[model samples]
Target: MKLKNNHIATFLLSFLLTFLCAIPSIAQTPNSTYTIEQGDWLSKISKKAYDSPHLYYRIIEGTNEKATSDASFLKINSANDIRIGQKIWIPGLPSPKNLTHVPKTDCEIRLWYNYQIVAVGVINEKWMQDGIDLETRAHKAYDLRHKARVNARFMMQDKEAVKTLQARDIKKYGNPDGPTFTYLLNKSMEGGQSQEVAYQTIIDSSSKTDTRYNADCQ
Candidate 1:
């Protein structure tokens, strides 16, 4: 009889422990909301909220299902089509914190540019080899460029600066083709100018070239 009672006590104790352990998971729920503003898109919001732009689907699933019947405020056709002033329910997002801002110095910029040039060169060599179709090479090159830009953003800690650099490069050299980036990189290294100065020089030269081409076309 004592052994039977001991078995019952042990079973109750184990059940109590299991139930207690599961309480936290069961009690936790999604309780946060986000108000949309200008330039607010799911990808950008997810990137800001969750540190990954790929999780935009979570916002759609969490918010749209709970949307009011009128659908005037929370209706979303696509992640890209979110309207300003709409309220979005965001689940499982951590509280927002200020982003760490690293100082942007000339040497850091130059180092980033050097690393990007090398990375792009390797990608081009690997993808542009014989027997690779032009479409495949183009797709690979685009992916490489995106990865390099993301890496550069991390190193530079300034998205605007990276965008400016790429835009200027595109304006000067037409797309971000590997050879053009390599040439500018070599020139910057040899010239010993600050990145700001080198960038200005490239922009000025590109403007002049455009003017000459336009004149020639007339």
Candidate 2:
């Protein structure tokens, strides 16, 4: 009798452990679909589902496979090309709590924001030179620009500080040569005043020698 009781207890414990281990996988099943709506770009959808807009590539890869094939589908060429009313498959994503948000100062935020704008402008000019359609180029530009802004926002924890900097940028620059935030931040960082001043100074000095920014790629 004693031996039988011991055997039963061991069996129950093993079953309990196995069930507990299976819970997480069951919870993470990704057999879900999302219908695209107005202003619903792949990056935005990825951000909402996975906490980072950069992860849209995962959705494209997962859904483009034969497993999720359906008649009513929109081909996803780039993150910028999803149309309204299209249905997309949602892949299993890790928990949002696992993601990291890097903190940045107001000055750093402005600099990064401007850098992205200029980078997007450069890409846009290239696309024009390549003779890509206006609509496709516009979509790609919007996606790239939006991703840059979203990334800058993610790096900073202070929302109020960002707002203040944006307002200051608009009031001061009011349509400057580069993006408003970039120009203002560059000016602020000039003369080695801030920590980033050294890096910005190097970039500024090199601009005189490098014609990449001035090249008439278009």
**Whose TM-score is greatest here?**
2
Question: Cα lDDT of model 1 overall?
Answer: 0.53
Instruction: Estimate TM-scores for all models.
Output: 0.29, 0.30
Model 1 lDDT per residue over 1-218, tens place: 99999999999999999998676322212456777776667767776766655456556756765575536447565667677667777666322221233325534443443334334434544555666654454445445555544565567666686677678767876754223534554576576887655543333222111112122221
Question: Candidate 2: misplaced stretches above 4 Å?
Answer: 1-30, 66-68, 94-218
Which parts of model 1 have CA positions greater than 4 angstroms off?
1-31, 68-73, 93-218
Q: Which residue pairs show collisions in model 1?
A: none
Give each model's whole-structure lDDT.
0.53, 0.54
How far is 82's C-alpha from truth in model 2 (Å)?
Answer: 1.0
